[model samples]
Target: MLNLVDSRSVIKIIPYELIMDTVNEHSCHRPKPTVVTISDLLATTNNDDLRFALLYDPPSVVLHQCGGSGCCQSKSETCTHSEHEELFLEIAYLSDPDYVKKTYLLAWNHTACKCAAKNNNRVL
Candidate 1:
């Protein structure tokens, strides 16, 4: 169960099924499945829909992981994506299999070189 807390501390509980409507739970280390339809991918011809699809529920956010190439390996030695777009959904699935199965609201960690154990606001 997820509880959304507002500024006033008003809590709203979101059901698991509602949040996971677009994802499927599978074996760990397997590719995460996307429910985003082909029509949804086609609609991303425009920037707005593309942004929505990439950020909210990207159909391409699966089966990929950073190999410490690109920004995952920086001169600063931190997991910074200043020069490249960080792999978002792939790392999310790697970080938390259980949580990733529940929502597409997954985020990548900018501070951790490997898949992070905790959630962060950073994304591509």
Candidate 2:
């Protein structure tokens, strides 16, 4: 009888403060995610083959197929954006100087894992 009463009492005193804090945390505004435009990607590289491939070829031909060793090694099975300052600066000139998007060859997609064929391509 005493155990049941204590259990009931414990259940009745719900932690309202924790609930409110969680609600507030979820409600707080988050900044928008950065994305690069096709034009921006095109303008960054001087390689004629890459420029032509991006402009003329379909995405299927431009990117490598999924299920590679790299895919298996990655945490999300997707290659995340790398923070390379030199690469960032190279691509930064194509976009707004004040708000430059981070440079990345790999695109983040759960179902699909198609990225540039080689390191030299440098397509985002």
Q: What's the lDDT of the predicted structure labeled candidate 1? A: 0.34
Q: Write the per-residue lDDT of candidate 2 for residues 1-124, one digit (tens) a residue.
A: 1122463463344477866666555331221234444454466567554444423212221222222313322234333222222232222222333443333342322233332334433323
C-alpha lDDT values of all predictions = 0.34, 0.34
Q: Could you give candidate 1's per-residue lDDT for residues 8-64 as a string of tens digits?
A: 896878787965552333212222222334233335345443333333323443322
lDDT of 1 at 24: 31
In candidate 1 the C-alpha lDDT for residue 120 amounts to 36
Question: Which candidate gets the maximum lDDT versus the true structure?
Answer: 2
> TM-score, each model?
0.18, 0.20
Model 2 TM-score relative to the real fold: 0.20
